[model samples]
Every structure is written in structure tokens, then in C-alpha cells.
Target: MDESVRFDPKSPLFVNDPHGMLSILRERHPVLWGGEARALSGRVFSVWHLFSYADVGAALKDARLMREIRHVLTDEELGRAVPIPEEFQTLVNSQRNMMLFRDPPDHTRLRTLVNKAFTPRMVERLASHIQDIATDLLEPWPAGQRFDLVQEFAFPLPVIVIAELLGVPKADRDRIKSWSRIFTQVLDVEVSLETLVRGNQMTKDFRDYFRDLIAERRRNPQQDLISNLIQVTDDDGGQLSLEELLDMGILLLVAGHETTRNLIANAAWIMCRMPGLADALRRQPDLVPGAIEEVLRLEPPVMLTSRFLAEDLSIQGTAMKRGDEVSLWLAAANRDPAVFAEPDAFRPDRSPNRHLAFGQGIHYCLGAPLARQEGAIALKTLLTRYPRLTLAEADLTWTASTTFRSLTALEVETSAAPQ
Candidate 1:
């Protein structure tokens, strides 16, 4: 048996068949030692794999779990480890504008400001806009010709919606996607120098663009998220600094759209595979809310979240000192039979679904309400518009990242007439 078989980074089994592999790992060794895996950049990463429901949950909610590891690698190791170049770091730092990367008061303040922009009322209001965006994007589809649903509809719609929310320029939407794709490559364990460089440059360009956008908004304020955030004043009349503003803007642009793109693609791919479930959605549109939750449980957009232990804690009967990285596999936990009944089946009408697709406790996804709204709307629209929607081919490729799961592309045939 291949040693990497259980946790092989290169095996299709790990990539295409994570659930199955995870099942085996749980049965044999719930908390398995991954030892070290060589990165594409040739750096070795020592990871501790946690696979059970209770274990993963405890790690996520545990106060002892920290997010940053300092001095884990020796000075020599630091030299060998893939160093994010200074230029790349500078650009990446420019993007470190928002709550996703920060801790404590900063994270809390930024999240509060962002939340005000994405309130339930705000999300409901955006429904018409979302519908219009989806309609416009799909309306031009040539009926008889096959199209990649992901690239054409799933990908662009979220980008446009998020751009509108963030006050990003209409003309720069496509370029935002390009930069986002590059900047997002750091999520992979095997980070590439080229992607790091590209991601850095992308952030720099975005910062330059947003600084100008901020100045414009200050000069001539509008009704977008940027303007809303800029004008946010506390009882003491304090506002965000220039650096905070730029960071928050860049974070919203990149992380905001990236997660939803995956959610939309993953949900659609799952539905297409299960004909009955897809049919149920077509017949009962109201069931979309439940269905979205179920799909999020089965295949969450952000599959894994890691916490660097700030203090000593025990998980799955294992003791950990401060600074250990605890990875919470959301996808694995969502399907854990221990928590959810018949975890693998796609039940559209699942009741009391407590899946942690948006995570749990303090760090729950800030855009949870918005993401659900967009996903439910998109899925319902796609199914309603094309009841006969079917995959053009079944062999779709998965993106090469352990932390995130999404189809690289999914070509489909729809019932609509050729435009």
C-alpha cells in the first residue's frame, strides 16, 4: 500500500475522492499524522490531520486554537522555506486590508462595518440586482452551443455582484477576476513563486486603483459599500484610516468573490450529478433555501480552516502545546454521520440543518447571509430556467487545492433556445 495513499498530496484519490479517503482515515486513525508532504515549491510541510466530527468541531470552537505560528521553523528552515519575496509581501500586505487576516479588535471592527453593508435587509434588496445580473449573464447564452457554466455564469455573476457592493469600477470587473485568481494562489500548500509574484502585483494594482476610488468617493460620495464604509463614524467621530480603508476594500474584493464562485460551482456540480435532487429543486423552488444548506453541508465552499493554537489545548485525546496548527476540515465534519443523519445523501428538505458551512462560534463567515442569498438565488434561477439542464460531460476537473474544493470547469446543455 502506498504510504501517501492515506494522505497523498498527488493522488487523484485524495483530490477526487476526499470523502471516501477521509472515511477510511476516520475508521483506521481518526487523528492521523501526515508527517511531511513536499510542496510543488519543494518545501516540506508537517501537518496533523484531524478527521472526526467531534475532533474537528472541538478544534474550531476551542479557545486554545491559535491562528499564527511564530518561530516554528528554524532560521535555516526559514531560508529554505518558500519566502514570499519582499515585493510580493509588499503587494500582499496592501491586500491585507480586511478582517479575514486580522485578529481581535481590528477583525471585530472591520467585520462590524462590513456587516452593516451586508445586513439581511441589504441582502434582500440585492435580490433583484442578483436576479437581474444572473438574467443578463445567462440571457445571451447561445442555446444550442455548449458553455462552461462555471466561467460564463457561476464565476462572473458573483464577481459583478461583489464589485457592485464594494464600489469597484464596472470596467475593471474582468481585471478583478484575473487579479483575484492570482492573489488567491497562496491558499495552496504548494505555493508557487510565479503565483506569489503575480498575486503581489495584482494587489498593488488593486490598492492603487482603490486609493483613487476612495479619493473619488470622498470627493463625490455615492450609495455603494465604499461610500458607506468611508462615512462610518463612531460616537466619538472616528473613521477608518487610509491603510485600513484600502486593506478592507482589497480583502472584500478578493476573498468576497472567491468563496462564492466556488460555492456556486460546487453546488451546481453536485445538483447535476444527482438528477432526483435537481428535479426536486426545479419542482419546488422554495426548497432552495434548505437545498442550499444541504449542499453547503455536503460540499462546503471553504473546505478547511486552520487555527494556530495560542495556548495549550487537547483535541481528540491528543495534547497540543501553544503554536500548533489545528486544521478544521469543514467538508469532512459536515458529512460526519455522528452529527448529520444519512450525511452523504442529498436531501433537499433537510430540517434543522446545523451544518457549519459558514463555520461556528466567533469567526463565523461574515458574508454568510449574502452568500446564502446569492447561492440560493443562482441555483433556483438556473434550475427554473433550464429544467432540462444536464452536464455536457461528467469528467470535470477539480482545482488543485486541499483547503478549497471547486470544479475547474463544468460544461452543460440547457433547454433554452439558441440566441
Candidate 2:
């Protein structure tokens, strides 16, 4: 590893403009070995970053590159040899059970059940409702006035949609959002111990809340996902255990909205910078889906994901030992010149577009269809309603997390209020 190529993933500069740094890495060290970085729980660990289009795409589906953390580190290596702190143990256990962090049979089983609830028909069914939600959210913002797109629009839109899907009461949306935000901290590559502790508490709170909901659903079924999941049986006529249910619920609630929120906000941010782009989409609403794909390629919500080597392997001539952590830089892969023409340019009409935004292989994002629908609806509706929408400020604030490319807030103004 070249000492000059080392960069902190969590640094403000890197978080704000990762592509700039990533470009250098792709050019010189496509599969650079990035050394120790602190995880959310303040644990330091090493990682190898795959930056090239070829490397990332192959690694995403590479069976040897596994998702389960336990595959990489043994119980003793993870400090589980000694008595673990209760809060830390809760947090660790929660992550271990999450479908995102699991592999093989466990992942396949959980995903199969989830697929039943989050089907294409179900997503298509919500299209009109999603449009209505977007319309309602945009209707209140007066013309020629400014509002935070994240707070007033992007954040609430998906939160409400996912909450409704889960059968969570409207009154409890705020609480759900709070817990989701806390839980998201642990997803970042860098986080404080304090944040981890709070996240553990939120996990417990979420578990208790959903436990009651699950019980209620059993006694009285509803048309929502929670109820459907409760009744969903496996091939053996088995059901998700209580812990599985809670973990899956948390995963759905958090993953369901966070990425969509970022996608919507990122689309708005990009349109604000490019004049007439929004109008072009408004004139041709059919182009919105392609535009969303472009945004996913340019500003992927989740920038990077980790995989551990299941066995010794030589990737692009670099030898990697078994159990070594490999960070697949999806954002960087999307911008690789070898695969994309003018990869940095935001060309909405770019065809043969195969971006790794939703990932590749069996572990690809399950909420991808719903996210696309929500993003297209939200962006098209906003552009149609606020024709002259523009960024309120030249400089914007972004979340200081390497794993997620997100704006803390996006302020915009319209020439005239919607009728």
C-alpha cells in the first residue's frame, strides 16, 4: 500500500466529495489496502478497498467474499472471549441477526419471507398512493419561499410510506424516525461509543414496540406488511422466530426509508445544480426512471459495503488472505471510466446503464423497486409543481459518514407557489 494514497474515509473532505479522492485511488491503486479505521462502536479494524469497476462488480457476487462478520473474526478475535458489556452485546447480537449482515441459508430464508411481502405487485399497488403522498408534501410549500427538502419532504415522504407499510400508527411516525436515525449511526464507518450505546437502547425500544405490534397482529390481523410477515411460512411451514421478527422489522424500517430519503434528496440537489434538467424531466416524465438510475450511479445512497474473504484469493493480482475484509466501493465503480462513458457526467439518458447502486448478486437490495418508484414520483412531482425550484444556498451540508452519501439538509426555493 502506498503511504501517500492513504485517506481517512470519515474525513469531512472525503465525505463531502468522495469521488474526487476515489478518482485518484482508482487511477493509481484500484484495489488499495486501506488500513485501520474506526467502526461505529469505536473499534479499529483494517480494510481493503476495491475501487475499479471490474473489481467491485466481481466482488459483489463473489461467493468467497462473505457478508457475515463472524466468518471473518472468531469469538476470541471479536473480544467475546471475555464478558462483553450488556449494551455492546445487545448491539452486536442485533447486527449478527440482521439479514444484511447474514449469509447463505439464514439470508436466503429471511429474504424469501420478505420477498413475499415486498413483491412487485405490492410496490406497483403503492405507486398512486406514493404520488398522492408526494403531492401532499409539496402542496404546502409556498412559491418563492424556501424550505428544507430533507426535513419537510425527502425524510418525511419515505418515513411515512414505510411506516404505513409496517402498519405503524401515524402518531408514532416521529418516534420511529428518531429510532431509525439513531440506528443508522451504526451503519457508518466511523462513530462514537456514545452513539453505539444510544443505538443499543433504541434497538431495545424498537424490539419492545414491535413485539407488542406482532402480538396484536396475531390476535387481529391487518393488511400491512407486519401482519403478512407474521403469517408468512417457510418451506417447512416454519415461521420467523421472535428475535428474527424484531431484527427483520428493524432492518425493514431503517433500510426501507434511509436510502430512499438520500436518493430523493440527492436528485433534488443535482437538479438544483443543473439548469433545465428538471424541466426536461417534467416535459418527459417517462425519463424520470432513467434519471433516477443516473442519480444512483452518480450519487449512490450507500457508497460502500464490506465483505470478508471466505478463502485465500488473488483479486486483480493482489493476494488477499482468508478472513480479510474487502470494502467494495460501489460509488467508485459507478464512475469507473473503463465501464462508463464520461462516467462523471450526469447523463440521464445513458443506456446500457448497469450501475452497482442496488448492488449485484443475491444480496442485492430488496427495497430497490420501491425506492425507484418513490424517487421517480418524488422528483417528477416536485419538478412539475415547483418549475423554478433552485438551491437556496451555494454550499450545502452533508452527513459525515463514509458509508452513506447523504445531505444533512437541502434548502430550495420556487419562483411561485403551487396552485
Candidate 3:
């Protein structure tokens, strides 16, 4: 570890400029171990932070690095962790059932079922509707007016799209969007007890809400993703459990839109910051796809992910004990010069870009297709409508989280009236 370098994910400076903060440490080490990392359950474990692209990429695919640690940890180790507050138990239970935290059979089961409902054709079909929603969000152009693009545009678009896709009704869109925001707290490395209690209540409310919805779908199936998922069964004729169904709903509702919202907002922020980038894309719309890829490479939605060592492993000659956690800095790896030429410089046209923004292996984001499409459409529509947009605020704020790289608000001001 470099004693001179400090890379605290929660610090304001790190949140504001993660790439700038990670550059030196990444150049110095492929793997940095010998520190304690805190888990959501209030347990502390020995941690290793993987910095280089090759190591992070391989570690993601390594079978020995497990996503869920409870299965491998001894009873004593599990008991040593702080117990969940009684009120927070329900949320924790539902969260545990999510595929994001599962391994092997459970992860395979959930992802397979959801994939049946989330087909490529389904995402492809939403293109026109996504464009329409984006167009309506910017109605009347708001030209010459200052608006928070995040609140007004970027955030709502994905939530509305994902909600509608999940069979949520038109009237419930606003409520679900608010719930989505609160649910993202689960991704934060350090969450306060107050937040946890409030989330407990929110959890109960949404569980009951989904319970009713799932029951209705059972009675009369609809054309939505939830209804489709309910019908999926294994070869032995087993279907998702009621608890599994509810948690899956919550996971999709939260993970579906939140990250994509960041993708769109980050891309917009980048374009505005880079003069003529938006105009160039507007002139040559074919570049939009590559531009989105570049944005994903440059400013990925989820920055870092961690895994527990299922067995003893040696990464770069450093021994990592079984049950220890390693934090893979996907954001840092994306900037690895060994893989990318001039890694920091944005090149929309850069070919053979192999960035792990959406992650890799079995846990690769299921919603990557939809996210890329949504980002492409949303940015294409926005820049097409307003070619001269620029950041309105002198300074921008980001959410304080290690897992999420989302903006608090993206204020934008148009320089002149649209032609």
C-alpha cells in the first residue's frame, strides 16, 4: 500500500473526482490488501482492493471469489457480526433473496427466469416509446430556462420506463420512483440507522404492495414482465416462491432504473463538459452508440464491486485467506493504461473498447441491453432537441456512495432558443 495515497470512497474529494484520485494508486499496485473492510451487516473483514484491469477482470470471473459469504463463513464468524435491528430484518431478508447477492443455483435460477421476461425483442420494442417519453419530458424545450436535467429529465425517464415494463400502473409511477431513490441506499457502503428504520417501513409498504400486485397477476396475467416471470418454471415444474417474487420485484424496480439513470446523466454531463461533443453526435448520429460506450467506459454507473474469497487464493503473490473480501475497482480498471491507450482521454470512436462498466461473468448486468438502449435514445433525443445545452451550475454534487456513481442533480442551461 502507498502510505502517501489515500483512496477513501466516501470522501467528498473522492466522490467528486474518483478517476483523479485512483490514478496514482492504480499505477503503483495491481492489488492492495492488509486493510479492514466493513460489510453491510456491520461485520469487519480483511480486505483486498484490486486495481489493475487484468486482475479485476480475472477476479470477477474467478470461481473462488464468491458473491455471497454466508454460505462459506463459519457460524462463529457470522455470529461475530452485529445483528440486524429487529425492524430492519424484513428488508435484509428480501435483499438476501435478490440474485445480486446470490451464488450458483440460486443466482442461475433467478437470472434465467428474469431473462425469459426481459428479452432482446422486448428491449428493442421499447425504443420508440422511450424516445416518446424523453420527448415529452422536454416538452416546450424549456429553452433559455434553467432546469435540473436530472430531476426533470435523466432520472424520471428510466424509472418511468422500468416501472411500465414491470407492469406498474400509470398512477403509481411517482410513488415507485420515490421508492426507487430510497431503495438505492442499500448500495451505500455506510448507511445510517435512521435510514435503515425508514427503509424498514418502506420495505413493508412495498412488500405488501407487490404482494397485492402479484396476486392480481396470478388471477389475470398481463403482458408485463412481472406476469411473464410468474409463469416461468423449471423442468420439474417449480416456479418462483412468493418471497422470491416480491424480492425480485424490488430488485428489478431499484436496479433496473437507478443505474441507467446515472448512465444517461453521466453521458449528458460529459457531453456538456466537452464542447462540440454533443453537436458532433447530433451531426453524425451513428456515433451515438460508440459515444455511449465511451461514456460507459469513462463514467460507469456502478464503480466498484466486492466478493468474498471462497477459498485461499494468491493474487499477484499476495495471499488472501478464505472468507476475506476484495473490492474490485471497475472504475479504476477502466482507466488502466495496460488495456486502454490514453485511458483517461475520451474517445467516442475508440474501437475494441473492452471496459467492464456493466461488469462481467455470470453476474454481468442483466439490464445492460436496456441500459445501453435507454442511454442511447435519451441522449440522442436530448441533443437532437437542444444542441446548445451546457451545465447550468458552477459546481455539481454526487451521491456519497462507493457502489453508485450518480449525480445529485444535473442542472443545465440552454444558451439560445432552438431553431
TM-score of 2: 0.95
Q: What TM-score, to 2 decimals, does candidate 1 have? A: 0.89
Any runs in candidate 3 off by more than 4 Å, and if so which? Answer: 1-5, 38-44, 80-83, 416-419
Residue 84 lDDT, candidate 1, scale 0-100 = 56
User: Per-residue lDDT of 168-255 in model 3, one digit per residue for the tens?
Assistant: 9999999898888888986676788878777877888899999999999999999888898899877667788999999999998898
- Model 2: per-residue lDDT, tens digit, 82-185? 45578667777888898999998888999898888667888888999999889888788866779999999999999899999889998999999999999888
- Listed in order, each prediction's TM-score against the native is 0.89, 0.95, 0.95
lDDT of each: 0.74, 0.87, 0.86
Q: Give the runs in model 2 whose Cα sits over 4 Å from its true position.
A: 37-45, 73-80, 417-419
lDDT for each residue of candidate 1 in 1-419, tens digit (9 for 90 to 100)? 12454466446667776888777776666776666545324545546667777887777676566443332334454345566568678665564445665566566676666666556776778999999998898877745557899999888988899899887888988888887777667656567778878777777787798889999999999888899888886545667788888877777766668788888888888776776788877778889988888878888877778766566656666666554455677777888888888989888777778887788766788778888989998998888777666789978788878767778898988765322
What is the Å distance of residue 376 in model 1 from its true position? 1.1
| lDDT order of candidates, top first | 2, 3, 1
The local lDDT score (0 to 100) that residue 190 gets in candidate 3 is 73
Report each candidate's C-alpha RMSD, comma-separated, in the order given: 3.7, 2.3, 1.9
Candidate 3's error at 143, in angstroms?
A: 2.6
